[model samples]
Every structure is written in structure tokens, then in C-alpha cells.
Target: MTGPGQNPNGPGAGLPPVPSIPLTDETARDVAGEQSVGGLVKDVMTQVSTLLRAEIELAKIEVGAEVKKALRGSVFFILALTIVCFSLFFLFFAIAELLADLGLYRSASFGIVWVAMLVTAGLFGFLGYRKVRRLRAPERTIETIKDTAAALRHPGEHS
Candidate 1:
């Protein structure tokens, strides 16, 4: 008869006593090697694997946060750009009409207005490119990766 958690044929079963002996030198050496180097190596590998998994999870979270921030910023920038573009269009049309009324259409006034519009478009494009570069700079991502790798490499160094 055995208890619920006890296996009838296992060591927990009521059985005859067994003899014990002192460990021999070769047996002791084998056991020591398994407990020391082998066990240590297994533990280190497990820790590193866990650390890498945690870092990957953190990277996913950080990337998602960064992407959300970028998207929100882009939305606001697009809205502002739309308003500015419409305002510029209206202002340019008004100026062109004024030049026409002033008897400048047959002269270089129309060409100058077109050239100015082209320059304005190019300037806005350049500004947008600069803004995107600033927003998506790799510095933050690189820093995060470096910090995470360092933490994983020396987890015990923190505290």
C-alpha cells in the first residue's frame, strides 16, 4: 500500500535496506567534473539564452513604441504641411493676380513666379527630408541595443 504521491516500486516504497560504500577516487572525480565544470557551463548557457530572449522581447517593445511615436509625429506634420501648402498656394495665386493687374504678365513676372514656386517646393522637400532624418536617427536604436547587450553580458554587475 502506498500513499497518493508515492510510487509503489520507487525508493519511497517499504523495501529492504541497501548497503552503501565510500566513493572511489575515479567515481569521485567523475562526479566532481559533472558538478563543477559541466554544471557551470550548463548554467551559463541557460543564463545567456534567457538573457537573449529577454533582450529580443525588449527590442520588440522598443521598436513598437518608436514606430508609434514616429507615426503620430508624421500625422501631425502632414496636417501642418497641408495647411501651409494651402496657404502658400493661395498667397502665390494672389501675388500672380496682382502682377497681372500691374501689367507684368507679358514681361518676366510669370517666369519669376514659376521659378519661385519651384524653389519653394524644393526647399520644403529638403526640410521634410531633414526632419525625417532627424526623427529616424539610428543613435537611439543603437544605444538601446548596446545597453541591452551590456546588461545581458553582465547581468550581475548591476546589483
Candidate 2:
């Protein structure tokens, strides 16, 4: 059986009685009455400023990381482009020579390869332009900023 002044149905049935905190005027007023509206507003403004600063720092870190990744990728991409550009002359020259061997005039064979290369380049460039045109702004960051603004405007409401 639980002793008097002991909790009977908790995880510990005979737990010792906890000490009470004697409230002072400030604590009593904080617990039982409204704090001054000015104090409350100051506290909220301080917290919101801190939160916005943190958000800005997080965005900067995120953007910095992404920029580093893009820089690394672009370096490799440029290297590949340089190598391909140097190699294409040999490849197209071989094609032109093969065409000349197949009984076409040397000038005509070279001109045909030039025309074909131009058409292929134009096709790829158009496709890349369309793909880039479809790129959109950063949606997640925009959404988060919007949510923060809404929360700041209506502190009591939650999504």
C-alpha cells in the first residue's frame, strides 16, 4: 500500500514529495498575470531578429556549398570540352579523307563535313537553350521565406 502524501499510481508509487518553489513578486506576476505588452513585444522582436539572422546564415552556407559543387563540375566540364575540341579536327579530317577516297572531290568532301558539323552543333545548341529556358527559381527557399513572413504576421496561426 502507498503511504500518505505519496503518489499511488505513478511509475514510482512511493516517490518523495517534491519541494515547492516560493514565488516572488515577479514570478507570481509572470505566472498569474500579463507581462507588460512592451516587454512581450521586445522579446518577440529579439527572437524574430535572431531567427532571421540564422536563416540568412543558413542560406549563405547552402549557396556557398552549391557554388563550390558547380565550380568543381564546371572545371571537369571545361576539360572535357577542351579535349573534344582538340580531337574533333582529327576525327573530321579522317571522315573527309575517307570521303575523298570514295571518289568525291577533296574540297567537296571537306565542305560536306563542315556543313554536317554545323547542323549538329545548331541542333544541340537549340536543345540546350530550351532546357535552360525551362529552369525555375529556387522554390524551397522561396516557400520557407513565405512561411516565415506569414508566421511573423500571424503568430498564433500554424500551417
Clashes of 1: 0
> Per-residue lDDT of 1-159 in model 2, one digit per residue for the tens?
876766688743533333222334667656787769898898777776766765665556556655655555455445545544754785667665664655666655665666666555555555545544544454544666788999879979978
Candidate 1 Cα errors over 4 Å, as ranges: 1-36, 99-158
For residue 96, model 1's alpha carbon misses the true position, in angstroms, by 4.0
Give the whole-model CA lDDT for all candidates, comma-separated. 0.58, 0.60
How well is each residue in 1-159 modelled by candidate 1, as lDDT tens digits?
765766789832653222222344667777666767787789777766665665455555556656766675565456556655655665666565664545555235644655566566556656555555555434444675687678778877863
Top candidate (TM-score): 2
What TM-score number comes out for model 1?
0.41
Give the runs in model 2 whose Cα sits over 4 Å from its true position. Answer: 1-29, 88-140
